[model samples]
Target chain A: MGVGTGNTVLKVDGVTKTFGGLRALDDLNLTIEEGTVHAIIGPNGAGKSTMLNVCIGQLKPDTGTVTFDGEVITGKQPFEINQAGVSRVFQTPAIFEDLSVLQNVMIPAIAHRDGKFKLNPFSILEKQDDIEGRAVEILERLRLTELMDKHAGSMSRGNKRRLELAMCLVQQPRLLLLDEPTAGMSRHDTNRTIDILKQIKEGGMTKVIIEHDMHVVFSVADRISVLARGHIIAEGTPDEIKGNPVVQEAYLGGSVE
Target chain B: MKKFFANQWLVMLVFSAVILTMPIWLSPIGAGYPDLLQKFMIFGIFAIGFNILFGLTGYLSFGHAAFLGVGSYAAVWSFKLLTMNVLPAIIFAIIVAGLFSVVIGYISLRRSGIYFSILTLAFAQMSYNLAYSVLTPVTNGETGLQLERADPRIIDSLFVEPTEGLPLTNFFSLSLSGYEGFYFCAAFLIIGFFISLRIFRSPFGLKLRAIKSNQTRMQYTGFSTKPYLLSAFVISGMYAGLAGGLMAATDPLAGAERMQWTASGEVVLMTILGGVGTLIGPLLGVGIIKYFENIFSAINENVLMAAYSGLPEGLQHFLVTVSSPFVGEGWHLTLGLMFMLVVIFLPGGIMEGFDRIKRLLMKPFSRNKDAVESAEEGH
Candidate 1:
């Protein structure tokens, strides 16, 4: 809304969620404009993951509704929400460990194309050239082509992150949600990941990233939102967020480096 | 891709040839009898269907025998009320078993892991008790349901006169008994094996494997896994049903004992002992267990001593005495020891053992790096 003229892809309204006596999300509202990389940065225990969970339908918001593409999607199943063109990458890579890396990427594309359910037990997987081509393309883009035949579980942490990202990208999702995509990765790997993130931005897929790494945040994020006590403390372009007094006091605890 | 289909066709031909020639090749080992060969084919179908569910999806269903039992009852009822034709009986059996599985799988699938197993087990036990007592009119209870000369065969009698003796289940005019019966079951097994292969290589099968690997990942990947699982459950149940129908087709009898938990356990043992996930492992497991059940259980001290007569008298007697207990009336002991060994050492069953032996033999010719790599490919 501040800079982009694109339509809103996701909107959270008065979302409140509680665990026991503690509120994880307290009347928080946010909007993600189309084709913009939005970063949500927070200190520990600031309900960053809880907000993502609610958006992806992993957890139900107790009070408010979630709107995606102008349709209310509250209380929908995770798969249904995903089928509606939202894909997620976990903090820890959630790739299918037993399956080959190619399959990990191919599965989401198949789901994306085939809808929620299809009973094609007799159709050969090898014959699905379109899906396979998409998977291979995504893998090559993420530099995962060499590891396509390897089991997903056997990949290094960085490679698995790339693999998980490949899995999401293969779906051509309208919106991508990544939770600490470089969490445990080396600095070299993190830099390569930021490059990969930049490469995919041209596809016009809106992204909401929950990151602790300031370098990743500033490099890929177009707009930054600082979260504290389950609500947005500040929202602006990265440079504005860096200079904002409230965001510095609440999240950074000092001026941005 | 064409090469894959070519390989599949080659596998089909070789399987058919082997199954068709079982009588010639197995005669030396004394398992060539029609009755025993028929059991092999029937149970081979059972395990092949089972692997589709347990092997691919990783749903350990302990109540499969209930489907088998239900199929038998349905087949016999079909023979009594509808027709004496084998096709109708088998179809009825499959349909009924499919319906039964939907109910059982629907309830049992609500929970997972050991709870899923316990739920299936409970449903099967309840089914057995009902068939044995309250549903005695349908199941025939203690005596079992058998073809009766007095019972109606509406479809068959409409076309031809009823014979005075008890009617035989037949395909058209061809009687399904003796060698013909074995051949009938073998045909079905071959067809079932081919279908199983198709399922193993298909996209649906990939989804099932994904579910088995990590269901949460599958869900987040935009798949509703319930329908896939239920379809697999019903499909496997129909397989057990077909096996049961074949049983009644070959020998015109339906017994409540077929529904017993022990019977379910036998199929599980057959699947695990052969290689749970391998295409042809369950058949080997079935052949071995069925061969032992028939051959080993028939061995007495006299039979043992006669076989060992070439040895010295004292040694022959000692061998007979020592082996007799594990043979006749104690064949389970031998099976138990084999199961134990397979579980402890060959955890992937007989197929894994074969894989290792094949690798070891090839290790000398190939580089160590390639040998290790190829070994990992199958895993």
Candidate 2:
């Protein structure tokens, strides 16, 4: 269940992250309000992932403030940021392949619910009924209840994406940062993922998704920001971004007459 | 209900049962089964600890035996100064090894993959060299450290003596007779097995595996993987120390050779050969290697000659010449060959082979059920 009203939950102000001489992200500034699906659209090497990394503390911006719920979390460790309610799903499904899908989802849920790294040998699964019940519900929402017993590695790419999304959802994260949620999916699977995202947003979760597919972005994005050369060129509602000259120039090439 | 056997705990329980029953079943055969079994269990403990570090974290440590050696030395020192109590000795060994692993893991983990392995190996070699030369009084140099009968143990406790001419301890208290020591070793192995099982199921263990699979991803998930990796390294090192402490308890000695690079290689071989990630594979690998070392190495030319009387003269002579290298001294060559074969053919070790056979047997029936389910779903 996504928490909070759609007021500004995360603020990234004038953030710049550079690797050696190459500017991965240049003077990026964006404010994500609570309870809305925000889409970051850009081409390859467009610094989309870098911006996500900076926001979540995987990478430090050379100069900028990333404030989540009013705390400066720019240089914090990934886990610390995660504990603060920012969860990320990787481009490639990063799941425990050998573990059952239930165990895979159970791990992060347990970590979040217990609020500490657990060391006791007692059955954590047994003790955590609410977490387990919620995880099962999330899996059901994704139509992954039947695959709960299957090894995560045994699943196809589409199913793995669902599993990753389920893991993030099960954490009940404040802001779920997804990198290409439908990266390697077929058309049917992409549409299904869009449907899932639509349902999640409808259910009141704040999501920031980076997608290469313009169709996927247009389908569920409440606000669209067009990023070009490490800076946001335009930010508005879907209709405005769709008609903006800069956005068209950035995506369609050359100056629009 | 029948499918419950697929649970990891059930497999571990079966393994523990087999390891525990070895002495009882094999002692009647009059072969030195108990002695071999004890050695296997000790090395098995060593490999299990090693598998946690190398298998779970994907950190290949080539210097792990340094911790084992450190444990042995720590136990021997405790034996020399404190009580002859095995508990204190083991505790000291574990603490020392854990500390050593921390220092090593810290430096080694800074680099990933092959560099990490090389760093560990270099550190281990340094440890071995220092123990052999610079640390003469503490390590006792080439002669290694040995128990003197005159060394005063504050709390006088009697331990079982070693078997005749074996020059090691018996069970915990009785003496180092083959039967008693074997059981003592078996008991510790079972304990180590359970501890490993706990570590595997713990949340900490889950994080360690996550680090192995995707360190960067784990970090992004808000877990600093360094501490988790280091903690696992120390825990595994403590297991190595326990194995070393048991060795000291049995033989009451510590040698630089125990921490040698070859010893490190042997444990890696054991873990890989048995099944790198599987719980029981390392023990099986240890048993396989030790079996060749203890039993095959004992077969000499005289033994071969004794058996030759039953064969034709030319065939007997040919057999002796061809088999000479594999028996008595060259058994390690055979072991190396076996390791290579296992690595190549059974990459998952005995566990993979076992799983393959099980899957093959279940496949025909299992596939039909899945097909039937889909057929029903279509309706």
Query: DockQ winner among the candidates?
Result: 1
Best candidate (score: lDDT): 1
- Model 2 lDDT at residue A205: 65
Each candidate's chain A: what TM-score?
A: 0.97, 0.93
Cα DockQ of the candidate 2 complex? 0.44
RMSD of model 1 against the true structure: 3.0
Tell me what TM-score chain B of candidate 1 gets against the true chain B.
Answer: 0.95
lDDT of 1 by residue, A51-112 (tens): 99998888999999999999899999989999988999999888889899999988888998
Candidate 2 stretches greater than 4 Å from native: A1-6, A121-132, A252-257, B1-17, B24-34, B157-173, B301-320
lDDT of 2 by residue, A1-257 (tens): 13437578899999888899999888889998899898998777889999988888878899989999889998888888988898888888877787778877877786677553545443433445776788788899999998998989999988988898888888889899999999889999999999988888765668999987888998989888888889898998878987887788787354222
For candidate 2, the per-residue lDDT at B182 reads 70
Clashes of each: 0, 16
Local error of candidate 2 at A77, Å? 1.3
